[model samples]
Target: MAISKKNKSKVSVDGKEYLWWVFDEYDQTEFDGIQIKAVSSDQTHFIKYGLQQSLNNSKLVLALKNYTKLVHLSLPPKFENNEGVITKTGINRMIKWCKKDVHHIEYALDGSRNDLTEAEKQLLLKELQKIIR
Candidate 1:
């Protein structure tokens, strides 16, 4: 006669918090005690991993300095002054620091975007690399 054994329960690694993350989605990602970095509530950010600028812009700034030659793209004129309100927008524009730049790809994809000489694909690759490093 064979003795019946009890069914084994599934085990989760690093308990339920850390390991359980991969299968789930997070709205905000924390770093250095701050939730400043946002983790998309989707799979792409989870599946594809690396340094996202939302986590740290300094890293990308350093990468631009290292990989590309010296080039100063000035902040948009509208943002040149008025200190608090305009300066951030100006800086963000020059670096394409966040979604603002990426959002344009959608608009331009429809053919309304001017400045056709600068190809969208090329800009996408270049910006993606900057984000990666």
Candidate 2:
């Protein structure tokens, strides 16, 4: 993994504190050392979004489980666009590429495009704020 620019800081917002860092992968090496924690699940979602944006590789597509290990891959445009006959068989293939023991995270194994819930949007906003700052 190549870190093009590194920014590490502590951000406090609305009486909450967070750790923020940015990375850039100039090389193809795997990026696996990112660590973040939050006081609540909502904050976790925000931190994740901020971290992901800093490591901007348009081809970067990660399927995470339980907020721990992430299965990173260079998914084709087909997958990103949610096209193709995403069947049980196809999902099985995708699952094969998953990290075992990562549990209880939201996954569209069937390759469906489901809208984020209100709670998810709020968490995403928190994440966006971290990046904008």
User: Whole-model Cα lDDT per candidate?
Assistant: 0.25, 0.31
lDDT of 1: 0.25
Per lDDT, the best of the predicted structures is 2
Cα lDDT of model 1 by residue, 50-89, tens digit: 2222322222111221223211111222322344232323
Q: List model 2 lDDT by residue over 40-94, tens digit each.
A: 2134322222123232341222322233322223332221114423333332232
- Per-residue error for 98 in candidate 1, Å, reads 6.2
In angstroms, give how far residue 48 of model 1 lies from its true place. 29
Q: Which ten residues in a row have the lowest lDDT in candidate 1?
A: 14-23
Off by over 4 Å in 2: 1-7, 26-46, 49-65, 68-133
> Which residue runs does candidate 1 get wrong by more than 4 Å?
1-63, 69-77, 82-99, 102-117, 124-133
How many clashing residue pairs are found in candidate 2? 0
Candidate 2 residue pairs that clash? none
RMSD of 2: 15.9
